[model samples]
Structures are given as C-alpha cells and as structure tokens.
Target: MRVFRILAVAFAAITSLSAAPASAQFFLKPADLSGPRVTGNEPGILGQTLTGATQTELDAALVWNLRAALNVAALQCRFAPSLFTREYYNSMLEDHAEELAKAYKTLGGYFERTSENKKQGVTAFDQYGTRLYSGFSTVGGQLSFCQVASDIGKEVLFSPRGSIDRIAHERMYELRRSLLAWGDQAYRGYFALAIPRLPNFNDDCWDESEYRAKRCGDFFASNDSKSG
Candidate 1:
C-alpha cells in the first residue's frame, strides 16, 4: 500500500508538471526599415496634370514612414547592432545612416505617389488615412525610451515634434548621438522595461484569462485580484 501511494504521488506530480504552460520568454526582435523592399516600374508621372494627393496627405505619409523607420532603428539597436557597426560601434552608426536613408526614400515615395494621384484626380487614402496614426508611433517611442532608461539609467533624447516623421528623424539623430556616447547597455536596459511581462500562471487562486477578459471596472478590485 505504501509503495502504491508513493507511485501515485509521483505520477500526479509528473502529470501536473506536464500540464503547466510554457513560461513566457521575452526579447526584442529587430524590425525591417529597408525602403519598401517591394517596388516596380510604375509610370514616373500620371496624366499631365500631376497627382491629386494633397500637401496634408504628403505630410501624413512622411510621418507614417518616419515612425516606421524609427521603430525599425530601435529593433536594430536591440538585435543586430553588430550588423550596423563598421568597427566597434561604427557599424551601429552606419545602421542609423541606413535607417535614415530608408526613411527618406519612403518619404519621397509618398510625395511622388501623392503627386501622381493628384494629377490623375485619384484619391490616395494611404496618405490621408494616416492623420491619427502618430499615436501608436509615439507610444512605441515612449516605450523604447523607457526600456533604455530603465536598463541603462540614462535619458533617451527625443524630439518635440507633433508630426511623426519629423519626430522620428529628430529622435533618430538624438538616439544615435546618445548611443555613441553611452554605449549599447543603456539601450538594452530600455528594451528590458519596454517589453511587457506575462502573468504568473502558477497562482491557482487567480485566473489569468478572467482578468484578461474583463473590461474596465473598479481599479481597486482589479488590483486586489491581480495582487492576490
């Protein structure tokens, strides 16, 4: 009887361990900033009138592209600084140069497309549709800054532009200079805090899925349950 009980306990433990969900892993993945790797021989100009895209559209597009590029630069800083470096941190500097180049290309493409569409009297929604898109980019930038600051105990220099593209460009320039002066550790620290943490699955009294499914309610209730 003693032997059977011991065997049953061992089996139960093994089964419980096997049923456990995998622990969450965190790491910053690099982003692609290379000029839209997909382009073709589209006509250089649309009808003689020029494209129908407006100045507002062009500005919005620029902001969209710049933010995208900045995000890519941040990822590059995380995963592949060696790819950016020429020697020591020079390669990282080069990576920033390449990121800026891509940003410019994307901006130019936006302008060209806008002009072409405007000439043909066709609306370019891609540009105009990006009016409020800067919010996400701003959040990403803030998270990136926080991650770097938390990790390296250094400040991330950012621009004060309301427009996404200009902010991205200015931020990149500032980040590049800061990186050169402070080294990669600071940026790595930023990533550590910027990335979200997973819930503790081992706590049986609290159901992670229930909390995730619930919408906004009493803040104190949510905090108490989460704490428990």
Candidate 2:
C-alpha cells in the first residue's frame, strides 16, 4: 500500500510538470512576425525613393533604413535599458562603420545623381534622413516597436560586419510591421478592461442635492458592504 501511494504521488508530479505553462515572453518571436521580405524598392518600407535607383542604391537605402530604425529605438526605447538598444546602436556604429559609411555615401550619390544640382542633392539627402527617423516614430505601438527593435538590435550585434545589410533586408519588413500595435498573443481576447459602474446621481436618487440612501436602497448598501 505504501509503495502504491508513492508511485501515485510520483505520477501526479510528472503529470503536473508535463502540463506546465509555456515560458512567458514579452516580445513576439521572429517566426511569429508578419510582413514580406524587403526588396528595397518598396516605398512603404523606404519612405521615399530616388528615381531610377540601381540595385546597389536600393541596398544602400535598406541599410540606411535599418540604421534609422535602430537609431529611433535607441532614442525612444531607452525606457527599457535592459534591452540595450542604445548600446547596440552605438556598438553597431563602431563595428560596422565601414559598411554604414559606404551605404551613406552610396545613398548620397544616388540623391546627387537624381537631383538637379549639388545644393538640391544635399537638401534631398537631409530630407531623406529626417523622414527616415520620423517614419519609425510611434506612440500607440511603442511597446511592440521597442520589443522588435530590441530583438533586431541584439541580432545586429551578433551579425558579422558588412552583413548588416543582409540583416536589414531580412528584418526591415518585420520592423515596419512592429510599428502597428499588437496585444499579448496568449491572452489577447481573454482580457477586458473593467470600468466600475458609477452610482446614478439623478434627482430620483437624490432629494434637494442630498443623497437619499433610502431611495438608492440596497445599491449603496451593497457597495458600502463590499467596501467595508
């Protein structure tokens, strides 16, 4: 009988362990993300395009887009320092400076080639930089944006130099998608905000602005009881 009881307890422990919940995570996994792979020509992803941009120019745009996204994360997502997006961005600047510089130069050249004059080219390049940063700014989707950017930033840190563009190409689409708000996947529809129902303050429930407890009856009584 003692042996049977011990075996039953062990079986229950194993069953409980097997049924344990999945680990909690704040951010969506990469496989869970939505959006198409960035081909660099998408106006939605790049913000604006230089007319007649070649493949090299397009790749440069993608690299700059990724940089701007991470920069935004560094500035805006600092609230969660543990994510270290700012650190990642700073390190990326040092580690991939050559590739990033080349991308910037390439993009500047594209603008210069497309614009009418040097002055206009400079203006166009400046505007592109401004728009690039602004495009990633978000209030409603801050949580999701920061989370996705944090993941991408860590990945960027691990990525080999000169391969930043490849990471940009692979993740930029998902980064853009993160700008839209996404709720907790596990409890998405299970939760609803509870608003306390206020007591009616109509004339029927009051007499000459004095609350008539008798008129209100059990409503206040129940609430008072709950409070007590």
Candidate 3:
C-alpha cells in the first residue's frame, strides 16, 4: 500500500512538470526598477476603465489628466523631506503651492485652447479637472499618517532613545508610499484616456505646451487658398 501511494505521488508530480510551459520559467522575472518613461503613456493608466465612457473617449481623457497627475505627485514627493522641519516645511509649502498652481494654470490653458479640437474637446478638460480633484483628495488622505508621526514624534521628545522613534519613521515611510500610490493611480487613469489615440495624431496636433496649435495651423493653411 505504501509503495502504491509513492507511485501515485510520483506520477502526479511528473504530470504537473510536463504540463508546465517554458514561459512559466520566466513568469516571476524581476521588473526594471528605473524611474518611469517620460514620453509614452505612464504605466499606471495602461488598462483602466472610465466609468461611463467608451474606451476611445476614455483614452482621450487620460492623455491630459494622467500627465498632470504625475507632475503633481512628483512635485509633492520631492517636497516631502521638508515636512520634517517647520521652517523648511513652510518654505517647501510655498514652493510646492507655486509649482502646483502653475501646473493647474497650464492645464486650464490647454482646456481653453483645445475646447474645439476634433480629437479632444472641452470635455477632455472637464475630465482632467475631475482627475486633479481626485489626486488632491489622495494628498489629503496622507495626513492621517502625518498625524500619527506627529503624535509619536511628540511622545519621543522625552525619551529620545525608544521604540516610538522607530514607529514614527515607519509611519512616515508608509505615508510616503500611500501618497505615491494614489498619484500613480490618478496618472494611470489619465494615460488610459490618451495613449490609444496618440499614434494616429501628429506630434504637431497634440503638442502639450501649445494645445491644438498644429490643428489650428493646418486648418488656416488649408483655408488660405479659398480666401485668396
């Protein structure tokens, strides 16, 4: 009976090994840990769904919002170290606010300028604005971690060589990770909106710095002969 059980187990193991594909060997390969690619659609938004819209429409919406969300998140993460010092935090907050405001203004300009572009219109801007709001809400969510850190930091003031300091450090890292994750999700949704349609459009047509400038230029040039 013991010999029969051993044979059965060996047969099952052999069958499982034979059924496994060569591709399975590389299934757990490590990803490249380098920073995200700047030119293509950001990774986070690659396969997201926009609740009420068709895939194409959502893709267009993602182009504008995803980039903005990434920029905001990057800036916030860069500013986070300053939060440890009151004076530095105040300075960083001023700088952070200015940078964010500039990004918001730039986004607003894109929306106003591209309101009539055939590929993406005012609706894209509205969708992008909604994404910005969502990203900001996530920023607010990190405050809970900050509060915990603050509490621990205060407790450790009396006994500076205790476990409370370690706990505070762990909480800070957790807060930072949470902020980054939220930003990535927001950007992912934005990329989903843009990447599918980017190939069909010319670089001139979708210039981020000068919204719809190429389309407007092409339209005028095409109409010049008619006016003449």
Clash pairs, candidate 2, are none
State, as a TM-score between 0 and 1, how close model 2 is to the true structure. Answer: 0.70
Q: Please, what is the whole-model Cα lDDT of each candidate in the order they appear?
A: 0.34, 0.77, 0.37
For all predicted structures, in order, the TM-scores are 0.22, 0.70, 0.26
User: Model 1, residue 94: what's the lDDT?
Assistant: 32
Name the best candidate (by lDDT): 2
TM-score between candidate 3 and the true structure:
0.26
- Expressed as tens digits, the lDDT of each residue in 1-228 for candidate 3 is 334533543464456556653321211322222232222133334222333344334334333332333334334433333222232233223323544344445544555564667346457756756655464335433533333222323332222222322332233233233332122233443432221112324566666755474454554444454344
- In model 2, the runs with Cα more than 4 Å from the true position are 1-31, 192-228
Better of 1 and 3 by lDDT: 3
lDDT of 2: 0.77
In order, what is each prediction's RMSD in angstroms? 22.2, 17.1, 22.2
Specify the poorest-scoring 10-residue window by lDDT in model 2. 22-31
Lowest summed lDDT across 10 adjacent residues in model 3 is found at 23-32
